[model samples]
Target chain A: EPEVTQTPSHQVTQMGQEVILRCVPISNHLYFYWYRQILGQKVEFLVSFYNNEISEKSEIFDDQFSVERPDGSNFTLKIRSTKLEDSAMYFCASSDDRGWETQYFGPGTRLLVL
Target chain B: SQQGEEDPQALSIQEGENATMNCSYKTSINNLQWYRQNSGRGLVHLILIRSNEREKHSGRLRVTLDTSKKSSSLLITASRAADTASYFCATDARNFNKFYFGSGTKLNVKP
Candidate 1:
């Protein structure tokens, strides 16, 4: 079974620095999403990307956050300036074109900002 | 805000025991999905139940959705030590493209 893949399984960055989390979603998937889990908290949605544009975003996806599909398979989330609160497990997910399709997720990148 | 909240944040059982987790949401939903996450790992899709359906099963996993009550339950029968993971319930509301995940229930199936 094809699965989503992410790079840099774990990252440690200084506060105020920029960070880019990369993901390669399932090849044939059209909808891509980013979510974060803060330690013991629930997984929170960050943004959804489709057709090279953002389809939806949450309040946590503020000015500091941006997503790009720089290539056919690569979907990346960039944080302009990281904050301590931004430290979390960032996950990338993708689904086929079918509406409400099951989303396949990557192993996730653990971002640690200090 | 619309959110999926799971009950009994933690559970522990021996191998071959059944585990049940429940989730409740505040509003109408288009579909409900269950996911499992190992410690510090990514989420794995378990099952999805549409609003029009009442119950669905896959292997040892059984899910039931009651849209009228805005609640759902997931039952894992004859669970094994490998089944020890945090289970989450996610809701997809109508016209909403994003999914809201619950806090999750941490299950510890001892061997």
Candidate 2:
């Protein structure tokens, strides 16, 4: 089965530095999403991308966060300036259909902003 | 405000037991999905129950969705030590694809 894959399984960066998390979604999938899980907290939605644009985003997805499908398969999330509270496990998911179909998720990238 | 919240933050059971977790949401949803995550790991898709479907099963996992009540339940039967993980319920709300996940239930199946 084809699965979503992410780059840099773990990332460590300074609080003021920028970070980019990359993901290669399932080839045929049209919808992509990014979620983050803080330690001992629920998974929180960050943003969703489809057709080369963000479809929906959460309040947590502030101006510091941006997502782009730079290429056919590569979807990246860029944080302009990281914060200590941004430390979390970031997961990328994709699905061929929306709102009703199953979404396959990547193993996730653990981001630590110190 | 979170859209979904899970009950019983933690559970412990002997091997070969059953684990049940409940999820309650605030908004109408198109579907409810169950996912599992091991310690410090990513979410893994387990089962999905559509709004129109009351119940669905895959292998040892069973999920039921009650639209009227805006709640769902996931049952893992004959669970083993491998089933020891955090289980979460994610909702695909009406008219959108983003997932709202609950806090999850941590199950420790003692072998």
Candidate 3:
């Protein structure tokens, strides 16, 4: 079974520094999404990407956040400047059909902004 | 505001017992999905129940959706220690591609 995979399983960065979390979603899947989970909080949607553009985003996805599909397989989330509150587990997911369909998720990247 | 919320934030049971988790949502949804996450890991898709469906099952996992009541339940029968993990319910609102997740229920199935 093909699965979504992410790089840099864990990262530690200083506040005010830029960070890029990378993911390679299921090859044939069309829709991609990014979500974050604070240590003890629910998963929060960040953004969804399709056709090289953002389809939907949450209020939490502010100007500091940007997503790019720089290549056919690589989808990345870039945080212009990290904040302490940004420490969380970031997961990348993809679905073969509509974004609402069942999505396969990657193991996640743990980002710690100190 | 959160779309889904789960009850019994934590549960502990012995192997071979059954575990049940309930989920409630605040809005009309197109579908509800259940996922599992190990400590510090990612979300794993478990099952999805559409608004029109009342119940669905896969292996030891059973899910029931009551659209009218805006509630759902997940049952894991004949559980094992490996079943210990946090379970979450995600709701997809009508015409929306995004999913709102619940706080999740942490299940610990002891050997």
Candidate 4:
């Protein structure tokens, strides 16, 4: 079965540095989303993208975060300046346009900022 | 904030025994889904039940939704040692695009 795939399974970055997490969603998926889970915490929604634009975002998705679908298959999340609290597992998910569709999640990228 | 809350954060059972987990939500939802995660790995989708549906089953997994009570339960029948993992319930509320995941229930099946 086709699955969502993410690059850079793990990343280590210095505080105040920038990092980009990339994902290649299923080829036919139309809606994409980003979510993060801090250690021992529940998953938190970050943002959703559709039609190459941000459809919605949560309060946690502040000024430092941005998402881009620079190409037909790539969805990228960029953090301008990493913080110690930013260390977590970031997951990418995608689904087709059908309402109430099930989203397929990628393995996730573990970001460690020091 | 709308959040999915799961009860009995952890459970353990012997092989061939059954495992059940419960989930509750505070807001209206379009659908509810169950996911499984092994240690230090990505979540694996298990099953999804729509708001209008009361029950759904896939293989040994059974999911029941009680919208009136705003609760759902996932039952894994005749679980195996390999069934040991964390199970989470996620809700796709009125905003179908965003999903809120619960803290999850950790299940340890002893062989």
**Which parts of model 3 are misplaced by more than 4 Å?**
none
Show where candidate 1 strays beyond 4 Å. none
Off by over 4 Å in 4: none
Per-residue lDDT tens digits for candidate 2, residues A20-111, read 99999999889999999998888988988887889899899999999999878799999999999999999999998553488889999999
lDDT of 3 by residue, A47-110 (tens): 9988889999999999999999999999999999999999999999998866678878899999
Which digits, one per residue and each the tens of the lDDT, describe model 1 over residues A9-69? 9999999999999999999989999999999998999998888899999999999999999
lDDT of 4 at A38: 91
- Clash totals, every prediction: 0, 0, 0, 0
Model 4: per-residue Cα lDDT at residue A105? 91
Q: Which residue pairs in candidate 1 have backbone atoms (N, alpha carbon, C) closer than 3 angstroms, thus clashing?
A: none
User: Could you tell me the TM-score of chain B in model 1?
Assistant: 0.97
Which ranges of candidate 2 are over 4 A from the true structure? A98-100
Error of 1 at B83 (Å): 0.4
